[model samples]
Target: MTAATDGTRVTIIGVGPGDNGFLTLKGKQAIEEADLVAGFQTVLNVVIPFAKNAELCPMAYRDQEEVLDYAVGQVKEGKSLVVCAWGDLNVSAKELLDRVRRRVDHVDLVPGISSVQIAMSRSGISLEDVVFITLHRRDGKESALEELVYYLKDGRRNIILLPSPYDLMPAGIAAGVIEDGVPGDHRMTVYQRLTHDDEQSWSGSVSECAAITTDFSDLSIMI
Candidate 1:
């Protein structure tokens, strides 16, 4: 255990796309030796085995500021801690970590397998054959989906989307495509929990998927 004033308050470790094995060796080591491990419930479950009697602090949706505050406080209190995240923490936790980074002098970010990387691997979709988009924003930005449809219809492009929780799901995307007047049933894939815990996949037309469940705790979409 060291103190944050020595440099940084938190060591952010990326557990890799829902699967612990995909986590970096350095990340595993950090968690194993950490005095405190903080993350969401899912990340906590996977890291628990390696945490050396570390206290856990689980953050729920959008509670990142609180988590970071606690982490910085702990570091000030001289506790060695590793903050867990999905796939590269820097990539997924960007919004908040950026703010936290300005407040702290040091943060160790560990990289891991990204969902897009895994989605490509699982679908055997050529890395060179697709465009990736993130539709998880609160604003129902149909512009992105509209543009994707344009490319898909041009028959010259393929897209992989990271859908927003329930507000902007694959089904809803399909609806958007139709609303945008893009016809023809496009093939789609949904990989739920990408790398762990009842991971599932469904390959079908975009229309059929609209009615399916959209509980994307950790998942991806391919179109």
Candidate 2:
């Protein structure tokens, strides 16, 4: 019988930039020994090779509820599990992890390199020079947009964008800033899937840049 039959340690793992290479040694070890791989199946697909013996959890929205429930159930049964995510330690991750923690006395956050940090590093921008807004809220907020516009107008601030998978990305954002009267030629960089082999980048401005029709499914944009 495998680890599932006897049960073992269950965790929510961070896969880091959708790259197996970015996975930490410990994280890889846990995944390899996990009884079940539970997470957004997109991320699951990306890291399947790492979880040689684990069962893949179906990709489901509101996976938090089911994933949390399953992990707790596994721990009770003594079977190990590892749930994956982009950053398994952020706010969204925290809220989800809290649910399982409430039920089980044991759980640990396995950290991974955040795509945001990777993008910032790749862009060569300091955290001090950037204003970050994670637009992935239930209710969107553009208040940051105003300040971003002002900063762009000043021509000195580097803007770091954590755009919601919902609203404007770097290209759209640049377009809006330009429409608001900021310099249309302001340089922008969109690091889609940073730290991954498929990672792509583009540089241009609101006034002259072409449409960005690429996959921003898991991405970070900098300007």
Candidate 3:
């Protein structure tokens, strides 16, 4: 489906990392002005106060195609839709924006505090010095590992978005890095549920982190 040709538009808003406090004023305003707010329930819940007047469309994490279709339909019908993206809009929002651009006349994205940023803050590292990679539904595990192995070996700090497929949590990723020539004693930190009430941070060597069997929230970040 295509967008309404008569100047109707949709706004893609990044709601920031899983906390309402992190929502930008502009993002909150966009949500309040929207006729329809579409995103994962966890993300949308953070902005519920602003979106109370808007029609809420809850999407599952695995339903990107369905959510895109819903947003496209709403936009084509002349509704002002605000699609909420987790983290920075440029991250998970890329695929949706690519498809929407082909069907819509105009779309704008509001930046948010990515977990990478929060993780960096928690670790006291400069964002300019970290190589960022997201394994969160980008490609297969093997490909993600290869990318991590390639980048982590550069001697620069890295911020990686861990994929929760099966058992590929921080521990697993650390193990993979260790096997790929990153020293077991290499320092690393894992941030879980950043900006949330139950947030936690773990700091240790790669091997020390690998030995941890505890599970973390799906929103965990490693640095």
Q: RMSD to native for every prediction? A: 3.6, 5.3, 3.0
Question: Residue by residue across 102-220, what tens digits does model 3's lDDT show?
Answer: 76677777888776777777778886787667676645757777878877777756655655644678888888889889889888878888888899888899999889897767878
Q: Across residues 104-184, which tens digit of lDDT does each residue of candidate 2 receive?
A: 555667888677778778878787887665555444447767777777777666767666664666657667777899876
Which order, best to worst by lDDT? 3, 1, 2
lDDT of 2 at 156: 67
lDDT of 1 by residue, 143-167 (tens): 7667677777776667878777767
How much RMSD separates candidate 3 from the native structure? 3.0
Q: Each prediction's Cα lDDT score?
A: 0.73, 0.69, 0.78
Which regions in candidate 3 have their CA more than 4 angstroms from the true location? 1-8, 140-143, 158-161, 164-167
Worst 10 residues of 1 by lDDT: 88-97
TM-score of 2: 0.77
Displacement of the residue 145 alpha carbon in candidate 1, Å: 3.2
Top-TM-score candidate index: 3
Q: After superposition, how far is residue 178 of candidate 2 from its true place, in Å?
A: 3.4
Q: With candidate 2 superimposed using the best TM-score fit, by how many Å does residue 211's alpha carbon deviate from the native? A: 5.2
